[model samples]
Target: MQIRTNALVSSVKNFLIEVGGIIDFTVLVFKQFFKKPREHKEMIKQAYYAGNKTFPLIAITGFIMGLVLTLQSRPVLVEFGAESLLPGMISVSIIREIGPVITALLCAGKIGSGYGAEIGSMRVTEQIDAMEVSGINPVSYIVASRIMATTIMVPILVLLADAIAIYGSYVAVNMYSDVNFQLFYNQAYNTLSFKDLIPATFKTIIFGFMIGLIGSYKGYYSKRGTEAVGAAANSAVVTSSLAIFVIDLVVVQVTELF
Candidate 1:
């Protein structure tokens, strides 16, 4: 009984710590965002690195996701003789849920972890200290830029992912049935409304914020030595993934209530 109680207390303590960390990180990012903008060159370079360079991975992942979703969904749809709805169903799922969520998860694994390790390493090596000594605002240069870059780039990536996923769905559709390009797209678009598009896109912005916030927070506060860098990276991914789900739940509930 004592052991179980101790375990429960530990879990709660860990949860609270994570929540506090998230809040602190968010405050720091926002504070930095509103501060005098410095390091434009560094910020731009980071944006290109974080955003442009991530495109290939995002595209490939998006393609495979659509293809697999369609391929797997076919038999189920066929059973209902609703294969005609393939494009529409896939499109809704992709745009409304899969595209943004999957893209964010991928980003969490790739970009989130990258940010954590990179910054954590800097912290471990006292590069951050050197920056302060050199009269550089490390928060604005590192955290603000990353947060801004993720915010700006994630939505764009989701849009591209949506398009590529649709194309992939088209290919998957053709494997078992014939669908003209125009007709397929028409069917797909006919089912989508501003309602689905707006909410999904909005949620993605939150997802991006969470990813950047968590990654930057872990890295910024990391302790110990080089090993802390790896730990920060790992924790950032794990926590950001959880944050995505938690935020999604709330978003969905709120959307439904509205």
Candidate 2:
């Protein structure tokens, strides 16, 4: 019993230390943002890579998500004789919650892992150390660029995903019932408000920041070895994915109070 209690205490201590380290690292990266010689070129390059690489996957997933959701929901709504609410229902769900969260998770897997592996390899190879020797700020050039890129690109990706998902929902709606394009469009559009759109988009930006931060942190602090690179990549994906769900839950609970 004493051993078990000590083990649990050790685990909690380690967890707290990790959290504190991340907080310090985050503050350091944020400070770099205001420093001179801003990495606009690197940031733009990272942003372009982020969007270009992730767009295809996001499109496919968004379409399938909407399609499956509508197909599953149609029967239940039909039984209740509320099939007319299908378009509005899909739009609200896809826009306000599902789309942003799914897109963020997808990015947490793809972009987050990519950043971790790339930076971890650099760390292992002493590239980061070489940069420091050359008087280049690794935090500014590497970490800041990535976090900013994700912060800007994620909301845009969420918007695109929301649009594509709505269209997919339309296709599913017409699978069994006749939903005209104009009528479906109107219903979906009318149901959405600034309240839903603004908060969802804002949440995605936070998601993007967390994904980038966690990925970069894992990579930057990884042990100096080849195996550490892989470990960093894996942990980045897991951490970012978990963070997305936690942030979503907190945001939802807070939004409900308003």
Candidate 3:
């Protein structure tokens, strides 16, 4: 009984610590964001690296996601003889759930890990200290830029992913059925209301913020030596992925209630 009680207490304590870390990291990023804008050039570079360079990977992943989803859903839909609903169903699922979730996960793997490693390395190498000694606010320059870049870029990438996914769905539809481009899109857009689009889009911003926050927090506070960099990167991805699901559950529940 005592052992079980201790395990429960430990679990609760760890949960609280993680929650506190998330809140503190969010506050710090926002504070730095409004404090003063610094490192515009570096921010832009990071944006390109995080956004533009990631386009191909995002596109391919989205394409495969759509293709696989459509192919897999076909038999189920056909069983109901509701094959015509494929476009609408795929669009709704992609836009409302799969697209944002998948895109965020991918971004967490790419941008989150990158931010963790970059900042972890900087911290380890004393580069962050050098910037401070030079009168540069590392928080504003490093943390703020990464936060902004992720917040902005994830949505754009999601939008693009949705588009590509639709195209992939089109191909998948044509595989065993007949669906013209116009007719497919018409069915898709018809079933998708503003309610679905708005909530899904907004939730992605939260996803972006979480990814950036966790990544930056882990990287910024990393200790040890070179090994810590890898650990930071790994932890950032794991924590941010978990955060994504937690936030997604909350957003979905709230959206449903409203």
Highest-TM-score candidate: 2
TM-score of 2: 0.98
- Per-candidate TM-scores read 0.95, 0.98, 0.94
Candidate 3 at residue 2, lDDT? 100
lDDT of each: 0.89, 0.93, 0.91
Ranking by lDDT: 2, 3, 1
Q: Which segments of model 1 are wrong by more than 4 Å?
A: none
Candidate 2 structure quality by residue, lDDT tens digits, 1-258: 999999999999998998999999999988988887799999999999888789999999999989999999899999999988888999999989999999999999999999999999999999999999999999999999999999999889989999999999999998887878999999988988888988898899999999999999999999988999999999999999999999999998888888
Clashes of 3: 0
Residue-level lDDT tens digits of model 3 in 1-258: 999999999999988997887788788778877666566787787789889999999999999999999999999999999999999999999999999999999999999998899899999999999999999888888988888888888988998999999889999999997778999999999999999899999999888888888899889988869999999999999988998999999999999987
User: Residue 184 lDDT in model 1?
Assistant: 96
Candidate 2 vs candidate 3: the TM-score winner is: 2
Q: Residue 226: error of model 3 in Å? A: 1.1
Number of clashing pairs per prediction, in order: 0, 0, 0
